[model samples]
Target: MKSDERMRLMDLLHVLKKRYATKAYDATRRIPEETVNQLLEALRYSPSSVNAQPWHFIVADDEAGRQRVAKATPDIGSLAYNRPKVLQASHVVVLCARNELPESYLTEVLDKEQQDGRYVDSTARDGFAAARAGYVKQHLDAGDVMFWNQKQVYIAQGFLLLAAGLLGVDATPIEGFLPEALSEEFGLEEKGLTPLVMVSLGYHADSDANARLPKSRLARDVVFSKA
Candidate 1:
């Protein structure tokens, strides 16, 4: 590899190593709007199976909205641990997945693809739609449509986390909250959306204890395999 290319790759590794699951945040500081917009774009462009894109992001940057999400982590339950992180972060993004992909939803996706010049002719569009229909049908038959959608949402979460890290922002990907309560609070069920995960974003507090801890991970030999 070229010297410059190696340096660029190393920079990305540096960013990944620097990022941690921030447990505490400086509430008084907020990420710039420009950076937040880029983070949203990162989520928007995340890849999904069959281009389903069956996910929605609810950005809670306001006091009321943040408080509503924080409520899902009640103080006396399994979810209590995440309450402080949610409340202290400058923004909390509620990652939601569609509960069902009705025929209309699939058609909408294909229609947009065609409009975006993804197809050269009607036959091409029809072929793509037919292929996607088969994939969706297989999952539906197995009663895994919701599970499939949830998996896609995690892809987007990864994009958000890496984007935030590259932009020098701290983030915590949280799954220890009450999904049902969050869905109800945000009227997600009415829209056929289910809350799957939440990410708290902000600058880490100067006094954050976690900032001083070393990162721990399994050895590369145990994690990676060459087939």
Candidate 2:
């Protein structure tokens, strides 16, 4: 590879190695509007099963909104530890999963795909639609449609974290909350949405101990093997 390409690859690897789940955020430090928009765009292109795109994000960029999202996490146990992260972060994004995948939704997505030149021919479009339907049906039959939808949302969350890393922002993926409370707090049921997970984004506070800890992972030999 060329020197520039090798340097680019090394830069990305360094970002991955340096990242950590920030435990505290400097409430005063905010990500720029342009950078935040870029992160949102990264989420918009996150990969999903057949590009189903069964997710929505509730971004709290202000104190009032963050307070509302923080309602689900009470002051108790390990969950309380994350409450401050939400309230103090520059922004908090609540990733939600669609409660159900209706045929109409899939049809709408496929129509847009055709408009965007996603298919070379009508047959290709039809086959893509059929495959998406088949996978949705299989999940429904197994009684795990919501679970599967939530998984897609998780995949998108990974994209957000990666983008945050490359942008030199601190991030923390949070799950220590009452799911039912979160759904009710956001009135997601009425909107056909269910809360899956939340991620806090900002610069790490001086008190953020996790930011100072060394990166830890299993040995490459133990985690990866030739197939």
Candidate 3:
């Protein structure tokens, strides 16, 4: 690789190395409006299986909005530990997965794909649609369609965390909340969405011990294999 390309590769890895799941957030700090918008745009561009885009994110930035989100986090058990992060973080995003994929949503995505020139012509669009539909059917027949969709959502979350880290933002990916409570609080079921995970974004507080800790991971030998 060129020297510039090698430098960029190192820089990106450095960001991942330095970033940690924030344990505490400085409530006084806020991500600017422009940066927040950019983050959401990056999230939308996250790829999925057959481009299903089977996720919706609800963002809470203001106190009232965060408070509403906090109501869904139970005060008992380990979930209570995440409640403060939900409320004190500059923003919290509840990542939702579609409960079911209906024909209407598929049509909607296909329409946008066509409108954006994703296919060269009608024949290509039709071929692409058939290929996507076959994959959807395979998941449906296996009774794991939701799981399949949530896998795509998780991929998007990975993208979001990396993008946030590159922007010098702290984040905490939370999975301890009660999904039922969140769904009810947000009336997500009415919109055909099910809560899957949440992520808090902000600057880290001095009290965040995790931010000061070193990152530990398996050795490259254990994590990779040559084909």
Candidate 4:
């Protein structure tokens, strides 16, 4: 890249880093629709395991709906009423992970192969063949592989949070809501999705105590190392 362009990029990076502060907006603050679209657009580009892209987002907007979620996820800590506020905010974005049934993976790959014009060399084809063989070896005797699938689903969750942070929208990552209760409350099966985390977005409120707390972090002594 040219020097001028590199310097411009660096300036933008500096501004973004400096601007990365958390502010909790109260439910009363109204969020604009365009801002919501920009946040979701950022998530659309986030990377996923094997491009599985197994995540869905549900935006909850009604009073009864938020109350149901608030009661269900109490263990999510401190902010027990967060779900209701989330529903009251200009918008509430819910992140969900779709369960991946093992049989469907093979079905998807075969479908992609049938449509694409790209060629896979014998070595690459053999590598995938070997991988499938090994996956079978590890799980054939076991009754389930739900744990493996959930781990990948979390990558999508992380992406959603980071995207919200980058869009200059204040968000609270909510997991305290009742899962099964929320699913039934939202009529999710009707939409072919499941709830994961509830994120509330809008302008920050002056009385939010969380916005006043210092950014907490563990010392490098415990968190990192050099070989």
Candidate 5:
């Protein structure tokens, strides 16, 4: 690259680095709805087990809904850590995963694939389709899907956090809330959703002190390798 191009790139990188200063926000700044939708849309494309896309989210923007979430959080972290600032933020996206998928849909989709002319033998196709359905049913009954779904949820969470930062919105990833509390309050069981993470989104306060704190990291020797 040319010298001028390299210098320009470095300047842009510095701007990005300075943007994410760990700032704590107050209640005054509100996150826009368009920003929230774009961030969540990024998560919708996240990879999932079998493309099941098991994750779900509950957008908490109303005062009553935020209060319910605040009440459910366990008071164990640093006082500043679990601040209701999240509740006051423009929105709190409660991430979760669906506990179950309808077996009928699974069977029907598989059966349709068998009829899509991918196989040469009609009789053999019936046998193969039946076996696949049985296999899927056995795993679904064994209850190991949650283990796989949890990985997808984390992927979505990572995407959401980065998208928020890229959009110039301040977001905090919170996991201190009681999942069961949220599940019950929202009646998530009926929707087949289980709570996983809470992400609060909004603009940061101009005078918040967290931005001034030094960023910390483990030594490079402990984290990276060139070989």
Candidate 6:
């Protein structure tokens, strides 16, 4: 491998090694708006099955919005552990997946593709949309469209984590919150969205106990298999 390419690979591995699920955040310190916007952009470009981007993000940067999300984290349950993280993080992102695909949304995606010069002719545009529609239909027929969409949302979450790491920001992907309560809290149902997961972003407090813990993972041989 080329020296520069090898160094780039090492850099990515280093970033992955350094990142962890931050347990505590420095509430007084906030990630700059510009940096946060870049992180959101990273999520925007995340890949989805058949180019059907069926996800939305709610950025709770304001105190009111954060507090609203915090309400979904009950004080006496499995989700209770994430309450303080929600309240104290500089910002929280509510990742939502579409429950159903409306025709308008399909049209909008195709229209954007045309606008972006993805198709050279009307036939090309229609052909591409038809191919994507077939993929959508298979999921719809199986009554698992929402499940497929949720999988795509997680791809965006992975992108968010990597982007946050590259920006030197601390982040924690949260799945413990109440989905029903969060949906109501954010009025997601009205928008045809279901809250699937959330991620809190901020700088970690110096005394964060999780920060001091060593990282652990399964053995490489156990996780990988040769075809």
Instruction: Evaluate all candidate structures by whole-model CA lDDT and list the values in order.
Output: 0.93, 0.92, 0.91, 0.60, 0.72, 0.92
Q: How displaced is residue 164 in candidate 2, in Å?
A: 0.2
- What is the model-wide C-alpha lDDT for candidate 3? 0.91
Candidate achieving the largest lDDT: 1
Per-residue CA lDDT of model 5 for 108-224, tens digit only, reads 555665567656777776676667556556757887767666778988988887777678877788876677878888888888888888888787776767666555668989999
Poorest lDDT segment (10 consecutive residues) of candidate 1: 75-84
lDDT of 2 at 104: 97
* lDDT tens per residue, model 1, 112-180: 999999999999999999999999999999999999999999999999999999999999999999888
Candidate 5 minimal-lDDT segment of 10 residues: 14-23
In the predicted model 4, the residue pairs found to clash are: 72-178, 73-176, 73-177, 73-178
- Residue 197 of candidate 6: its Cα lDDT? 87
Q: Judged by lDDT relative to the true structure, which candidate is superior, 2 or 3? A: 2
Question: What's the count of clashing pairs in each model shown?
Answer: 0, 0, 0, 4, 0, 0
lDDT of 4 by residue, 1-227 (tens): 99999997886564444333333456665656787777777666666544445567666556664555555555366655554455545566677765544556654653464456322665665566456546644644573444444565566656655665556666666776667876787777765566777776666677667666655568979999999
RMSD of each: 1.2, 1.5, 1.1, 4.9, 5.6, 1.2
Q: What local lDDT does model 4 show for residue 20? A: 31
Query: In model 2, where is the ten-residue run with the lowest total lDDT?
Result: 72-81
Worst 10 residues of 6 by lDDT: 182-191
What is the TM-score of candidate 2? Answer: 0.94
Mind giving the per-residue lDDT tens digits that candidate 6 earns over 44-119? 9999988789999998997898999998898788889899899899999999999987778998999998999999
Candidate 5 ranges with C-alpha deviation above 4 Å: 1-23, 74-83, 104-143
For model 5, name the residue pairs that clash.
none
Tell me which of candidates 2 and 5 scores higher on TM-score: 2
Which clashing pairs does model 1 show? none
